[model samples]
Target: METRRDLRGILFVLVVFVGLAVIWRDLRYDFNFASDMHKAELGRRRETITQTVTSIALQTQIETQTELTTEIVKLSEDVSPAEKA
Candidate 1:
């Protein structure tokens, strides 16, 4: 014994429920995608930090080698041939 007004009310409730389900699904997908992007960003930052540290260490080593070479050359100039005999 349902009237036309009751039928219309049921249809409205069904439409709202379907709309909410669609919105929930879309948000879940968006959250998962955002999480993946965050992980990738963290990995990239770690790599960049590692590369910068290695570059700084290599530059320091090279500078030390150059300084050592210069010091050896200066010392050699002071040596006399008589000292070698």
Candidate 2:
């Protein structure tokens, strides 16, 4: 009877240890998944910000070029009339 009791105790301890190990593994997996998802979201946001900045820079350059072209045309027209006279 004593030996039976000792065997039961050992079995119980082993079961508890197994349960704790499973719980720990599950928690670790969840933590890793969350960390990976956060990193992916951050990368996506960084790309979007970079694209928006580039688009704004291009728009400003085009506007400046347009303004310069208009000024050059006006100056050319003024010179043409003076030369015709």
lDDT score for residue 42 of model 2: 52
Q: Taking the tens digit of each residue's C-alpha lDDT, what string does model 2 give over 1-85?
A: 4465456556556655655555555456655764777656655654665565556556655665676688788888888666968
lDDT of 1 by residue, 2-75 (tens): 35435544655655565555545545655566477765665565456555555655665566567668778887
Reference-based TM-score of each model: 0.55, 0.54
lDDT of 1: 0.59
Tell me the lDDT of model 2 at 82.
60
Q: Sum up the clashes in candidate 2.
A: 0
Q: Summing lDDT over every window of 10 consecutive residues in candidate 2, give the lowest-scoring window.
A: 1-10
Q: Backbone collision count in every prediction?
A: 0, 0
